[model samples]
Target: MEKTNSASRFVDLVQTKKSFEDIKYWTWSEMLIALKQCQESPSLTNSSIMLKKCIDLLSQKISLADGASSSASSVNSSRFRSSCDSKSTESLKTNFASTTWWFEDLLFFSTECLEMFVQSMVSHEFDQVLLSKFLIHFQKSKFFNATSDVKMKVIESVIDMLDTLDENVLSLKALFDILRVTLGLNINKGSKNRLEAMIGSKLGHATLDNLLVPSPYGANYLYDVNLVLRLFKAFLSGGINQASPSQLAKAANLMDSYMVEVAPDPCLKSSKFLALAKVIPDSARKSYDEMYYAIDLYFEMHVGMSEEEKEKICCALNHKKLSYEVRIHLSKNPKFPLKSTPSSPESQQPETENLLQNINYSKSLISWPHNLTEGINTDEKEDKSSEQIVLYHGKFDLPADNERFKVHLEGMQWRVLELEKLCRKMQTQMRKILKSRVASSYCQVKSLPKLCS
Candidate 1:
């Protein structure tokens, strides 16, 4: 009998809390140990149910005590217990249990216990925002520098938490941090694919700095190209693209900037660079000037990088899309393999051809005041092209129009600046022509006088 007692005590795990009617009587560590043991058992679901009920009991007790406290302060300093205590009225005790009553205690739980707790809270339909904040707070308390085996457990729990979150409210920085932590763990890629999707869905909202997830030490590449590549593919795969061109543009532009930043790293390979650069469709970018700039930077740092590779990279840039300044720069770039002459009709229209027409750009820079009530008409009057307006937001609550409206406004501003520059150049040329004609007329007048003599 003593040996049997010793065997059971050796395990020291409390498998069930069926006896604890009020969880306030159960110590924090006692509950933690009990839950951890429950996680390994077949009756996990029942244990979770019991754990939740215990939490509910604890909240009711605390809340009721708080409400029924000694607000009626008279001469009440006696320590003797009242034998015939009267129950507080419903009006005095709201009996309201807070959802966050369990958040603090959850901090000490292992990843497994925390995940199960989160699942229970979510099943109860708690406010997702509050829950997400608690998770973020819980994350800050964890030791990220823990062993690979430990990190893998943490990452798995994080991914599970991410799965339960509303993507709209999922913090992008937190997502990035999770990926950053997994860099050297060498865990199975399949496990993190969900993380890629989570990051991708909201890729448009991400900043350049956040996208710059570096490769772990000993990695041949300077940055984690494959990770970002998967994210890019996942972003495109998700149907969020239907929303607006501007957000798509934002992602493409972000990728372009990322390319530029990573280009200078000597260890980065040409194929990897192209892999990321090519993920953004050609039509998404407003212009290839940034892409061209990134390619140029890549070529500059990687001198031995093959001419064929340079040509392949340059081929991705549509010459017509290159800004006038970029065209000039590319033409002068010694390494640039000039396939087509820089004098393309699309790049520069003859002055006489377009001089007759004032608003001669592709689309008039007019503000097409599209009313939200009016259904979007995508006919020739509204071809579903790059300029098609989509919903976006800026400072404060945006008007019924989306952020695409902001994109249109920015395009108009750029066109206005270009027009302004053209006007200044025309004024200078006109002044020069008038000065030359005057000098010729004066000479002719002097010659006429000489002829008369």
Candidate 2:
């Protein structure tokens, strides 16, 4: 008890700093070295005392960077600029606009340590974008040539902190990169499925290349067709009510391009290829030319496909949606797949369902922005309950037509875009001010060299 009291007394003095009249404060360089020493000792880094101190020091470093850009001086010894990795230091000199200078410093830590470290950062209420950017950087570096097992661990670690991020902070490309790395890895099936679901929720925004995931080793196929199929199913699982027509169109077109790229793989089975093609609804395809060419490519590569198999492949296409040139080409081929037989009802069932579901979905969508601004600014249930109360108490009638409702949402979307632009403008002005402060801070240093050569 006496020893504890003495140690506590020293800690309090170091923390409070009121009694120390003469002190030589450690630079961020020194503090960072100390922090790294603690991080290397897992026991110390995990402990509350060490973790809190590390968090406090990191917060100050970031604050210092934010308070002053590196351009403030040709050189400085006091803060983070001189203390961090040399590459990071040089990068900072060139990129004065970015306040996130610490992202590069923590890239070398193990995934387990990063998980704990990132969780700690999240707890400290660090900037959400900072956390997200670090995760992205970590993902890219670790997943570069990591084995399947290592990739799984990385995914698991990233997923934990990724949950804390607000929507849109992490880009779809980054998520797709993670998905690509995680694919074909022998991880838990449930975890992979969940990852697919998470990525699918935003798959509408995915570029065509994002869907081109390669098959695992030993597979004859060039790409993992099954993964794309599962992703498409997950994307559609939310139904038309959740996805606007434009988003659906984007996904369908992206899948069409993906099929075209993978169609030449002779080992790709007809059933697997057709399944993905058929999953796309007819209304979603503005043009079937790409789909037709993909089917044609598959036919050329795998000529042994039976008549029924060929018909099944061609059924994914809506002849009416095909352009004049494609229709002419299909008409000329004697063995053209579509020429085998008309699309049977079984083959067209998914499209019919999609159209009917879309009509029902149009009527069921919420008129206001409940779905739009969900999980924002208020507790979801309370926000919805309050909205209902307003509707019940005041005679407010929502637009019944989907078009009018979409217009309202679009208007809100435009206002959001305007606000985002305004926020960006404000950030630019603030950075300019910070840059000026950096310039002023340089002028105040009396011992500084006469001029930087």
Best model per lDDT: 2
The digit string of per-residue lDDT tens for model 1 on 132-241 reads: 77777676566555676876777767677867778777888888887787776765666678878888888889898887777768787777777788888888895645
- Per-residue lDDT tens digits for candidate 2, residues 179-251, read 7666556666766776777788888888877877788778888888888898889888977668899899888
Candidate 2: the clashing residue pairs are none
Q: What is candidate 1's CA lDDT for residue 142?
A: 67
lDDT, model 2, position 187: 65
Question: Cα lDDT of model 1 overall?
Answer: 0.62
Error of 2 at 329 (Å): 4.6
Model 1: residue 364 alpha-carbon error in angstroms: 23
In terms of lDDT, the poorest run of 10 residues in model 2 is 366-375
- Which residue pairs show backbone clashes in model 1? 391-402, 392-402, 392-403
